[model samples]
Target: MDKFFKLKENNTNMRTEIIAGITTFLTMAYIIAVNPDILSIAGMPKGALVTATCLTAGLTTIFMGLYANLPFGLASGMGLNAFFTFGVVIGLGVSWQTALTAVFIEGIIFIILSLTNVREAVVNTIPLNLKYAVTVGIGLFISFIGFVNSGVVIKNESTMVSMGNFTSPTVIIAAFGLFTMVVFYKRNIKGALLWGIAVSTIAAWIYAIIDPQGAAYYKIFLPEGVFKYESISSIAFKLDFSIFNDPSKIWTLVVVVFTFLFVDFFDTVGTLVGVASKANMIDKEGKVPGAGKALLVDAIGTTVGALLGVSTVTTYVESSAGVAEGGRTGLTSLVTGGLFLLAMFFAPLFVAIPGSATAPALIMVGFFMMENITKIDFSDFSEGIPAFLTIILMPLTYSIGDGLTIGVLSYVIIGLLVGVYDKGKKKVSNVMICLAFIFIIKLIVSGIG
Candidate 1:
């Protein structure tokens, strides 16, 4: 195991990797319940989706470990799934089968891009400052997710977002967890994140026992049962290619495919760069090692996830929890993937680890990722402005892809101006110029549609 994963070389051991994997799984296990619930609203079976979600995540993550040798987890993406259901199915009045077909087609295009090195070239083209900004942006994005999940932050009528009631049990519990994590982390405790999650979950269960009504009101409760398994027979292999039959629907299909492609492409790229940056896996050239294989695995995960009845499967940002926990190799991914497989039978138990419990870890990881902000060359406005936009817009816009889009567009525009004005001040690559044009076209098309 050490030889294969190069444990000593990476300065990580099996125990640390194991804990990191468990931490990563705990942080993201919400998807097992959330995905099925969201997709079921689109008229799919919830039970079948639970099984498919686990199966796809487990297999894909394991493949990532073995093939890419990167400590990242792949699962059906949260935003992409919402888009599949709400944007495509409900808004466009398209059938669920057609949405899945679009995802599958998008996956095929991604696979081709990966194989042809188009995706790698794009990754290589991103400037180092922007890459650091992406890491910092993702840190804030995930931290915002933690705050919202723990009920520490609430939607406000007048202010847009406000603090939740301190009296709320969820808020109190998450605070306790955060406090615990801070103490342990200060002492250089190993598995501080895992410990925080465990402590908070225990506290929640105790609260549920003491005041069941309040617990239920706050959506905090013990597991209903153990050892439950759902079959994927109903939803697997369910893609419908009927959109190709009608000439009128073909245009809609094209639009749908493009949307999926654009979002997944950038989301994956941003995640890979951000998480890799945090892990110190990027080389001197600002290139992530084994990125090609990682992209291929992600593409394959999406294709297989579509066949197994889910949205686009991509590398998860929550994997940063593992990376922050000192996970440095594929071993972490293997352990994480193993837990996902185990979650199939123990779904209720795993799902019972409330979002509040994991919220602290994400918030802490966000703090860790913020260190990258210091690395950005903020003295240069040409670089500083774009980097600032990238960092601030991620959490504000609540979309990594959108933040990256605006950042890249601004970078290209600013660089072009600098080059023209100062003659030798800045040089924007042709790839970046083309990308800015593409982003403009995407925005225009989306608006027109």
Candidate 2:
């Protein structure tokens, strides 16, 4: 195991990697329930989606470990699933089968791009500062997700969003978990986030047992039965390519495909870079080793996930928890993948873990990603302006693609202005500038559609 994962080479041991893997899995295992819950809203079979979610996450994450030798975990992403359910199925009035078809097609495109090295070229075209900003932006975006999930922040009529009732059981549990995590983190405890989650889960279970109306108040409770087998047959290989039968909806299909492609493209990029930065895997020139292979694994995950009836499968930001626990090699990913597979059998036990429990780990992971902000050069308006937009827009707009779009466009425009002013400075690449224009067109198309 040491030789295969180069444990000593990465300054880690088998034990640490194992702990990190379990820690990472504990932080993200909420998806076992959450993905099915969200996608079922789009008329998918809940039992089938639960199986698909676990299978995609396990198989693809294992591929990432063995092929790319990275510590990142792959799973059906949160926002993209919402887009599949709300944006495509309900908003655009597209069928769930058609949405899956779009996801499958998008994954195929990613594979083509990865194999041809086009994805790497796109990654290289992005300026280093912008890349760092992407990491920080995703951090803020993830923290916002944690807050929303814990109900610590809620929709408000007057202010758009305001603090929730602190006395609420779930909120109180989350607050306690966050406090425990912060204390452990300050003391440099390994698996601190994992410990925090366990503590919160226990507290919720206790509350459920003590209070007569506890189950009504808290989402987490002991399962009556732990073993319930689910089959993937209902939604397996069930994609409907018949959406193309309507030529009139061709533009809508185009817009939808572009939206999926663009979002997954950057989401994968942002996640990989953020985790890599934390792991010190990126070099001085901002190149990530074996990135193509890593991206190919992600592409395969998305493609197969759609075929199995789920949303886009991408690298999870929660992998930062593993990295935080000193996981540097693929062994961490291997352990995480194995745990995901194990979760398929013990689905009920995993589902009993509430959002309040996982929220603390996610929020702390966000804090870790925020360390990248120090790397940005704030004095340079050209870099700082775009970087700032990327950082803030992620949480405000609730869309990583939107934040990245504005960041890239701003970078291109600012670069050109700097070139004109400095006289000797080289101009920004025509390809990047053209790509920014295409994103503008995509936005306009989305608005019209």
Task: Give Cα distance to truth, residue 50, candidate 1, Å.
Answer: 0.8
Q: Output the lDDT of residue 448, model 1.
A: 88
The runs of at least 3 residues in candidate 1 whose Cα sits more than 4 Å from the true structure, single-residue gaps closed, are none
TM-score of 2: 0.94
Instruction: Count clashes in each candidate, considering only residues at least 3 apart in sequence or on different chains.
Output: 0, 0
Ten-residue region with minimum lDDT total, candidate 1? 163-172
Across 62-170, the per-residue lDDT of candidate 1 in tens digits comes to: 9999888789999999989999999999989999998999999999999999999989888878999999999999999999999998998899999999988888878
Q: What TM-score do all the candidates reach, one by one?
A: 0.98, 0.94
lDDT of 2 by residue, 36-84 (tens): 9999999988988878898889999898999988999999998899999
lDDT of 1 at 216: 88
Q: What overall lDDT goes with each candidate model?
A: 0.93, 0.86
Q: Which stretches of candidate 2 lie over 4 Å from their true place?
A: none
